[model samples]
Target: MLLVLSDEHKEHLAFLPEVDSAVVGEFGRIAVEFLRKGSTPKIYEGAARKLNVSADTVQHGVEGLMYLLSESSKLMISEVDFQDSVLVLGFPEDLNRLLLQLYLDHRKEIRQILSELAPSLPHYHNLEWRLDVMLASRALRHQVKPTVSLKLHLESGGDHIARVLQTDPATLLHLIQELERALAEAKTNHCRRILRNIK
Candidate 1:
């Protein structure tokens, strides 16, 4: 059952995680005002140094609150990846296919969040473009829904992508130190062949 939060609910949600207790207090206050005044409540992200919190801590805490609200709304849920950096929730089973908004609308923050979930990083602009076009096309130009697709789709002219795929950029430059050892082996191989020819 969806229970509508009121100004009276502020003191209750205060008991949530203390990632930014004071900022949460402010959110409660704004939530109450908006509940009573019918105004849009402002979202607050607290400072890192002031809270002695890393950005991932802040991002994860915010995502926690978002999931809480999603649970309240009874949204279908699934984790998008290993780091749990991206979450996508929707109800395709309903046929009407309701997709509730479970997001913070910042592109840069999404990019930064993805950068921490290492092994690799991906382009955030491409991510945004995919989603925007999905929303724009859904049940309008097309009835097909977006399922998470990660592998780069290949085209005929993909030489640059092929080269980059050969080595991860983060490790590419770091592998240079190993080249000298390979060169030493090659030099020894050449000297051994020359000695055989002279003999």
Candidate 2:
């Protein structure tokens, strides 16, 4: 059964075992607020002051929250920095299909962009493309999703340009179109060569 917590319930998530109720509530509150602002929350003294809890209590709350989130196999959390005390929590890779459709819709433009951009690097020769998809959640089974990334590597170069994520798809499409016309011309020349040698 999916547990849908209203904002109020999220604020009062007191079921976390072995931690003070106040600490659990404060941590949940902070997490919801950070999610609202679309960024990760850093646990520190300032956050403790805002939550009206001690820095140590805030630290405990952060740990409790991590534990609670970690219990679910579908959810994953990665500690980005121990010194900075920042944690990123989100869905598992297989179920994270938010940008799948966007990339698939723009696949042609994406390929054109990579083919154009990689050759500009020094000592460039040829390029390769790989596309993969994450299986959708049961609710979104009807939708087609592609991984929201492009991996580019030059034949003669080391790891220069590794991966490119989403950035202004519309603008990238325009730029991709510019060089694709040249690629089309190249294909035509190849066709001419084959025709001349056929007989």
Candidate 3:
């Protein structure tokens, strides 16, 4: 998957070229630490003093690195794909290699941190559905109308929520078909690539 950096991120990371490779490595470490322990203004200030740059510039540079690593890890792109993704930044060969090495070294740990940070949401537990057919009515004799009733159960954080829904058979069938179509689309290569880049 190709990770496309936004123009703003590109501008923010532009300061990296002037910095030393060891400083870039330090920025990578700081980025990961920021993810795990939140931001530290004092450290940024100290780095800014050492690099003779503004604290805001140092902060933005670290943040840009964080965004790069996190997005690459979230997509789990292969090494070649990762190298290709960073190539757009127009960094020198050694800088690109350093960034790639940083990504490779911390991808797993970054993913773990991201997963922990993600919000917990309700998920499917069970579904119960019933079909009700009316064979006759006072207005319409010898007529059939089918309705579908559903009980959708969801579980979140050890708590269960149940929802009741009712719809005509035609509408229910349409919804089912639409959902199936969506599932099929999600499995396509084009859709996968779009989704990967979306992250």
RMSD score of candidate 3 (Å) = 3.9
Q: How do the residues 48-89 of candidate 2 rate in per-residue lDDT, one tens digit apiece?
A: 676675676555555444333322212221222211121122
Error of 1 at 33 (Å): 14
| lDDT tens digits by residue: candidate 3, 130-153 | 999876679875657788899999
Candidate 1 residues lying further than 4 Å off, grouped into runs, are 1-16, 19-21, 26-46, 75-199
Instruction: After superposing candidate 2 on the true structure, give the runs of residues whose Cα lies further than 4 Å from its correct spot.
Output: 1-20, 35-43, 46-57, 70-199
Supply every candidate's count of residue pairs whose N, Cα or C atoms clash at under 3 angstroms. 0, 1, 0
User: How many steric overlaps does candidate 1 have?
Assistant: 0
Clashing pairs in 3: none
Computed on alpha carbons, the lDDT of every model, listed in order, comes to: 0.37, 0.43, 0.94
Better of 2 and 3 by TM-score: 3
lDDT-sorted candidate list, best first: 3, 2, 1
> How far off is residue 98 in model 1, in Å?
29
What lDDT is obtained when candidate 2 is compared to the true structure?
Answer: 0.43
